[model samples]
Target: MTTTHEISADCKACGSCVEICPNRILQKDAAGKVFFRPDRLWMCFRCGQCMSICPSRAVMIPGLSYETDFYPQPALDERAFDAFETLAANRRAGRSFQDRPVPRELLEKLVEVIALAPPSFPPVKTELTVVADPALMHRSLGLMIDLYDNLVKKMANPVARFFIRRQAGRETFITLNNHVIPLLKERLPDLKSGKEDTLTRRAPAMILFHSDRQSENYRTDIAIAMTYAILAAPALGLAGTIIDLIPPAVEKSPALRALFQIPAGSEVVGAVILGFPKRRFLRGIRRPLKSVTWL
Candidate 1:
């Protein structure tokens, strides 16, 4: 296996790396120079705190390059918070989209912002498949509708319903039986006949977030990444809604999986559908959280 750390000769003996390392893998030698403890090297989650704090730029992780990986932090001001508040307050779930496709450049910008999402650990396991074409989005919505239709049929059978309940647990089973099934049944004919799209809303683009099943925090990471994408979309002349309807369909069908290029064992955690809003909201609605108890 390749080594994880490399301490160059330019070490200034500042002890900054030693103090900032989360795992305390860096230690000061007799001359007070920094050195990595080989035994605890595996504990380093590559959070990059040491490298980010090191004044001498002497520390480098194997997979990270100082020249390419590090960038100067932007200056922050009161306007930053004001801008964020405005964005958050103005946010709306865009279910209605214009009949125009999102440009490839804007999609690339979205991916760039996604890359900056804070990871739960050193390396982010979340993978994104960007479907930039409206035609592909339509096809994907069709696949999702098919899956929901099939699910409703299977759920009608007692034996299959029992098995589904056991596999999906009580909460999910209840959600599907009471909410999802009824909704899908109502829209199935319209969806099949291309009269409407209640799920994907015929968005110009979509992004699927998936990760390996063995990832430490795939769900949390994907959620955060998805939030980042949603928030960044408006600034790029785009708007979107986070949709959960597509992942199950994508996961079950090999054709859908192949179309999205999701790896065989990976789980598609979430999705975001993006496009220009057919209409814009003039005001914001305030929906507070259900509970906010102070400790």
Candidate 2:
């Protein structure tokens, strides 16, 4: 028996597959049709580049191992660990922010870095929306406060009482907003002291990462990309907050979705409010590491 192969009629003969294939196993027939050169299949490395780079998505590999099974043993290297520690140590929840806006060039660079993050599955479909306007930031925060109030009212009586007293005299909404606002103030003293007037006073920019729920790795891809942005922001002298409070508002408010032009079938998975860090870090703090055991 011999292996069989075929191409879809939708193939545009773009030569992308031909150019990308490491093995010369595919050739164009007289009608500009792609075909497998039977003998050349021996040279195929199973790299699947042809399928991955196909713009028409017409390439299919039969009997392909869709999962990556190889796992290298963990090897601890002090230098590498130290390098990572330095990066993590530099990441502080910035509270105070400078009035000066973050440079467009820096934002662009950070996005570029985010684009290189690894996705959990192929064909990652994540989208990012950048909101730099201070007015828009305030509007988003206001909407979040509204949503918080709505949820607070719906909470169980016991839970509601717990939170009400836990808030220490602040309104329930303010208490919820305080989670981010306090961090924002600590990183941005000027904004905290009313020297600057804005919800994200120090942050001249914000980025919202969205992904479709249908994507197999939507959550993973969105989280990875957002984390990359968060880590990269500090290197650019910027601070950011990943807002979990915004998505429900996106779901409940059509006006909010339209304001951001988020497409139908897409959902806001993550949001990062970014700006220059006004507060400086003196050193890293130690945290207790627990909940791990060797089998």
Q: Tens-digit lDDT track for model 1 on 109-211?
A: 9999899999988698999999997888777777877788888899989999999999999998899889889888999999988898888888889999999
TM per candidate: 0.93, 0.59
Give lDDT per model, in order: 0.87, 0.68
Candidate 1 clash total? 0
The Cα RMSD in angstroms, rounded to one decimal, for candidate 2 relative to the true structure is: 11.1
Q: Write the per-residue lDDT of candidate 2 for residues 104-223, one digit (tens) a residue.
A: 788789888887777665455888887767667666655544554454454436676576557545664565555644544343444334465334434557787888777777877889
Clashing pairs in model 1?
Answer: none
Q: Count the backbone clashes (under 3 Å) in each candidate.
A: 0, 12
The candidate 1 region of ten consecutive residues with least summed lDDT is 1-10
TM-score of 1: 0.93
Measured with C-alpha atoms, the lDDT of residue 122 in candidate 1 is: 61
